[model samples]
Target chain A: MKTVYKKPECIGNKKPNSYCPGCMHSIVVRLVAEVLEELNVVNSSVMFAGVGCDGNGAFGYLDIDTVISPHGRALAVASAYKRCNPENVVFTYQGDGDLIAIGCAETMHAANRGENVTVIFVNNAQYGMTGGQMAPTTLAGMKTTTTPYGRDPKADGAPMHVCEILDTLDNPTFLARGTCTDPKNIIQTKKYIKQAFQNQLEGKGFSLGEIVSACPSNWGLSPLKSIDFINEKMLPEYPLGIVRDR
Target chain B: MEKVFMKGCEAVAEAAMRAGCRYYAGYPITPQNQVPEYISRKMPKLGGVFMQGESEVASINMIYGAAVGGTRSMITSSSCGLSLMSETIGWLISAELPVVIANFQRGGPGIGDIGPTQQDYFQATKAHSNGGGRMLVMSPGSLQEAIDAVFEAFEKANKYRTPVYIQLDGISGGMMESVMMPDAISDEEVAALKQKAKEEWAVGKMEGRERREIVGGADSGLPLQTLNQKLEAKYLEMEKNEVKYENYLMEDAEYVITAYGIGSRFARAAVNILREEGYKVGMIRPINIYPFPFEAYDAIDYSKVKGILSTEMSIPAQFIHDVQIAVKGRAPVYNYSTSGGVILDAVEIANHAREMMK
Candidate 1:
């Protein structure tokens, strides 16, 4: 007997994505597409894209209704979209820099309100499109274009653990952190993404899935080495697990 | 129906309910704060959604999202809060989304005071958002007009698929008066309205059809010039059909007083007093400020008119430039202004008109 592995119908045939080589955005997007197809929600799902490199190419890779919002405004827009059309599934694709830095207020408020929406946050530890500036999720000692020598705790403050912070909020129905470091981690990430959508579909308000991703070009490392970096350096700071579930 | 005595802010909120608005997002700011308060308590009872956004910026973006989803939505703010909202207002214009915004203006240039002032004349009529955007700016002088503008604002906003503004000052926002509120539409009617909008233009459920993409940037594949030309055509249509104003005693007059909103009330009163004194004085009250009643001035017998007085509540007079252009040098333009939320009295305005005539 012969078997066939097929791409989900939700994934547009516009590949390969425009993201740089070894970037994890395409992988995460593919997993989301597959989950949407399995849940039979491809027809009513809408994706709100952010301004990062990954977000700029999201609409091209996903065949669904999409709206690209200003930097740090995707959550607010997605919240409104979900409130207006409760039957349609809405989510936002945001980077760490967009969600944890400039959009902290929106991220907190939307979750506090328990809006029936999902947020897919990709934390690459730096601003990838704008040349790897130090982001809120950048590790304590990590070096980026903005950090120069290194991220100084005295001057730049410690990196924020968004999952831990959001776990304190009582309104979020689901909050989890996963990674794309290896095939095993990727599968785990996909599981979390599916569960987040399931929570929203079940009318469980405010689900968030954070994916710890790698940036090879910005980290000045090869694609394979970047995965090792995430395993050694980023994993300890951001432990992968379900931070909140109620 | 008997007239309902209500505050201007509450009347505006009730008017929005009558217009079938199902979503409201706003932040609390003085003068206009009552608007959001009323909506917050009432919308949920009507099976509508209401959100108190963290900031004015977030509130405007929320409305942008709801509007794109083909829902009747509105937001209210005061002068300073409106300044914070200018960015998203531009986004709404760029995307050609229909949304209603009501501003109960307070004194400003930088938190000047909490008093009523018409200092936002240039901000509203000349430039609201970037890229030369224009909105149908309707200034209401009375509580009755304030209620009526809110109902008509949603109509015109959806009609043109563009943003419309209801400009009021803090005085009217805080005052109480009898207003005939429009009856609410039936629940079935509201549902049908939403259904028609979604099927025609909303970004909802693209099943069995090409997916929809609404962008607020030049990425729509249309060149900047092309997009601007389309907007210009719409503005011209508005100018042709929507310009509104009142001509009082202009049949045989030597001096014409041009004013709007509260200033019009004072100007009209001054004109009546001057007329009783056997002086040829009249008033031209502009209801729509954007497509300013420039053409209305054409009816004036310029050969007999000596001057035009532009009255407002701002220090350095605004709206005079439009008056000058309308007069075309046929009659000299003068101004009478009182700033810092100081409303000029009818007696004082009458004296000023007397001086201008001299």
Candidate 2:
């Protein structure tokens, strides 16, 4: 199989990301970068970087009017900036842990409020930043540093289906969850991100795209096996698709 | 000026419209929501935009957006909604955006009750958001004051490029009374004012590329001497442009009472009682609290006034600090306050004043 080298302009100069070797974080990061460059929004749009590993999101790899927020706090900050300065396109790049865990309240409220902001939710089943801790999106039987015996719904709470919860909101005008695990999903995920940014530019409110991710080291698998886990395990639990569209 | 019997909330809305405010965004909450309901219909009639946002947080934010777009804008909400908006208010203050927020205060440490109270005094003034920028807060006593305050608030916010607030309670907000309305400025005159707004907002300007000027200050930590100079000039201009106060019946009165907004209304009723009983008393209501009518304090006969009675709706209360600043102990200052649930009554204020006199 052949792979496309990272685009020169899309090269995230920050460093090779710490994501697992075969991790799609690198691919998604490049795609988002290319889209920003393509849309000519790279310099104009203010990127509100989220918490956890995605804390330095925005590829953290570029020069932009970036505002890095405390964990789960990025959306509120981004929405506020956008609300105050609508001419400046604002969006937040977050993760399952950042958007779902401590930040859930702000996440749900931003969607419910239909704030004219864009959110890129990176959902890897385990906490990649702080050891491979089980995340809110961890599948029922997913094993992790915290849930060694395989998650017991009786012992641990059920993973919150984020896109579904967001769809329940009347204000979240666009909701799409895509994966970058393969060639096809990678193409689809880029399309979702481009649309999200376009909606924000057009003053459309509350658009979000969740990118389901993988963890090789934490899942006790090689880079190749981690892709299989996301495909076989994470896919069945958190399916990829558009949940809401206006 | 034509007179109309109006609730405090409605008067606030009318005041904004009269001030040439063309944009308003808010979500419905009790008490202050009436301001939005009235203006939303009235503004479009006059070719303004009234949008109901999805939530209080969003509504306030939308106001921020509109303000940045160089339009006169406002947002209104009660306690819970205001809390939700506190973070945005910080951003507004930081960005130095010009806008107005009408906080029709309600009870609570959290959703305590939507009933009337002066509980948000601390939040209104101090919560100007931990960024350390002083936001001017105006409290009005009568329907006229509410209307006038709303108009004045926009002007002050624009001049200073900071958020201004009209702080009142349910009693102050819901009460119905008559007010002398300002004559409408012709749409052409407004268009002229809108045209001049370019002087402040670059995009609104008629000529010149978007220029970022730098001023200098000695202690400004800003090495750009010119940038500091510009900032100092702006602050000096604001000092002259801002700060308003009202002094009523203070002359020859031994005990002068000081209050604002609903608290002033309570103070007025009490003052009437004392006046009818032949006690020498008067009231001073602060129309603007940031520039803080420093002149009002300078002009008063500190010796003639035996004491100053401070009344408000919060637990720690307010304006007493102003008393210290204005009077500086030339006269005694006494305070009366009720927390969260109720507006302090006329009788209570009168009693507090009578006791202070004794």
Task: Tell me, by TM-score, which candidate is best.
Answer: 1
Question: What tens digits encode model 2's per-residue C-alpha lDDT throughout B137-227?
Answer: 8877777877777777877787777788877777777878888888766778766665565366522112233222111011112344544
Per-model i-RMS = 1.3, 8.3
| Candidate 1 chain A, run of 10 with poorest lDDT | A9-18
Please report how far candidate 1 places residue B117 from its true position, in Å: 0.8
Off by over 4 Å in 1: A1-3, A14-16, B220-223
Give the alpha carbon lDDT tens digit for every residue of A23-128 in model 1.
Answer: 9998999899998899999889888888887577675668777787767777888898898799999998899988879888888988888888989999999999
B1-358 per-residue lDDT for model 1 (tens digits): 4489998888888889888999999988887889899999999999888988999988988998888788889999989999988988888887888889988888889887888888899989988877788889999989999888988888898889899998898988898998888888788988887888778777878878767667676543467788888889999999998999999999898898889997888888899899989989988988989889888888888889998888988888887878888888888888899888898678888888899888
What is model 1's native contact fraction?
Answer: 0.63
Residue A101 local lDDT, model 1: 90
Task: Give the native contact fraction of candidate 2.
Answer: 0.02
